[model samples]
Target chain A: GAGVSQTPSNKVTEKGKYVELRCDPISGHTALYWYRQSLGQGPEFLIYFQGTGAADDSGLPNDRFFAVRPEGSVSTLKIQRTERGDSAVYLCASSLIGTSGQETQYFGPGTRLLVL
Target chain B: AQSVTQLDSQVPVFEEAPVELRCNYSSSVSVYLFWYVQYPNQGLQLLLKYLSGSTLVKSINGFEAEFNKSQTSFHLRKPSVHISDTAEYFCAVKSRVGGKLQFGAGTQVVVTP
Candidate 1:
């Protein structure tokens, strides 16, 4: 009965460095999603996984933002050449694939990434 | 594409007072509405949702929201708020097919004694 969990509750890194944020979804969830929340702003969509494959990734800001879910259970969000503009809280959520896609999503505590 | 608009950016209310946070959404197709709350230093938690069957949905904590299809609005309300209710509340919407969530800027609710 564990909820979604993320690693490195806070991360501080220099500009141009690469960072990888990890997320572990619920036990039997088949759907995973990633979002980014900037200061004073709402969370924006990044990518989504519908199993081991990437289903919708249009929300990814640029080529530097990439995510993967190899075993359909755990996911990793990779950011290359982190910039000061990339500083924000990265959120992960998972849910069961509902028949009407109306399932409630459970969110993780999130990892706050600070680029200096 | 879907978008959510929270009319109030911040609201200050006294404990035991009634509170209401208005939320309006725009979408081409049918969507599901939700209310999420975030306490300081905590992650987002699902407060309530209106998917189907009921125009009014209530959470266990005495918060309730009514879905108005004609107005494209889902506003959250509480008869009497507690100091513990002070937090940031967000309004989000997603397509019925369920791909991603589009969130509003959020409303900060401050409850004082």
Candidate 2:
């Protein structure tokens, strides 16, 4: 009965460095999503995974933002050449797949990345 | 693309006072509405949702939200707030067929005595 969990609650890195944020979805969840939350703003969608393959990556800001869920369970968000602008909290969520796609998603305590 | 707007950034209320948080969303078609609450240093937790059928939904923790199609709003309310209710509340919307969500700038509710 564990919920979604993210690694490295806080990460500080220099600009132009690469970072990888990991997410472990709830057991038996096949749908995963990634979002970014900036100060004084709402969370913005980044990508979605359905059964191991990337279903929607349009929300990803650029090629530098990539995510993978190789086995349809755990996921990792990879950021290349991280910029100061990329400083924000990365959130991960998971939900059960449904015919209507209205299932409730459980969120993880985001990972706050600071690019100095 | 779906979008959500939370009008109030913060709401301060005395303990045992009624409180309301306003939320409005924009979408071309019918969508799913949800309310999530986040405590300090915690992830968001589901408060309530309005998917279909009844436009009114309530959470176990004495919180409720009414979905209004005409206004495209889903405002959260509670008859009497407690100190434990202090947290950031978010409004989210997504297409009925898509799982991606669009969240609003959260509303911070501070319950004071």
Candidate 3:
């Protein structure tokens, strides 16, 4: 079966530009998550969605970051006015129909974004 | 609030040598623990997890972790590491019922031939 996958493996944009990262979760998985990983650092949580609703989004750093999963299968993370600080690898993960703390999340290859 | 700490930023070991990655966490309530590995230019893969039952948990790749509640630690260990074991390891924790995870800075494991 296909695992979680992301589009545009690499994205390079200038500061103040807008960018969107896409994620396709595994089939039948109801939970989706987004995380960001900087150099020499572990992944930091960004947002989480259960079904069509966002179950938790406190991890989003600021108002410039937003994500949505309208159809409940694919998700998109939109960043407005990108900054150099946003340069990092964006990861997406998905899990079966279970509570967050107890479920195992499978990750995607990630999209490396560079904001100059 | 919950947070995880990986004490060792990097661990270098020769092939066939033993290795240990220390992890500690702080949380106001009981939580779930997880270990994830990431090769260069790749995504994270689940190594093991400690939800309940026994304090010691093992993965299929001859790696094991012992969850010590009293110490607030979940250290991962491998008796003998292979060259293929070189990767970045992350420690994560979340509240028993929460959806968001708090991750440590991560540890880089380098296996030498």
The TM-score between candidate 2 and the true structure equals 0.98
Q: Write the per-residue lDDT of candidate 1 for residues B36-100, one digit (tens) a residue.
A: 99999999999999889979999999999999999999999999999999999999999988689
> Which residues of candidate 3, in runs, are more than 4 Å off?
none
Predicted structure with the largest lDDT when compared to the true one: 1
**Which scores higher on TM-score, 2 or 3?**
2
Worst lDDT run of 10 residues, candidate 2 chain B, spans B93-102
iRMSD (Å), candidate 2: 0.8
* Model 3 TM: 0.98
Interface RMSD of 3: 1.6
For model 3, name the residue pairs that clash: none
If both were scored by TM-score, which would come out higher, candidate 1 or candidate 3?
Answer: 1
Worst 10 contiguous positions by lDDT, candidate 3 chain A? A96-105
DockQ, all candidates in order: 0.86, 0.88, 0.77
Error of 2 at A46 (Å): 0.3
Instruction: Write one digit per residue (lDDT tens) for candidate 1, span A24-110.
Output: 999999999999999988889999899999889999999999999999999999999999999999999999876888888899999
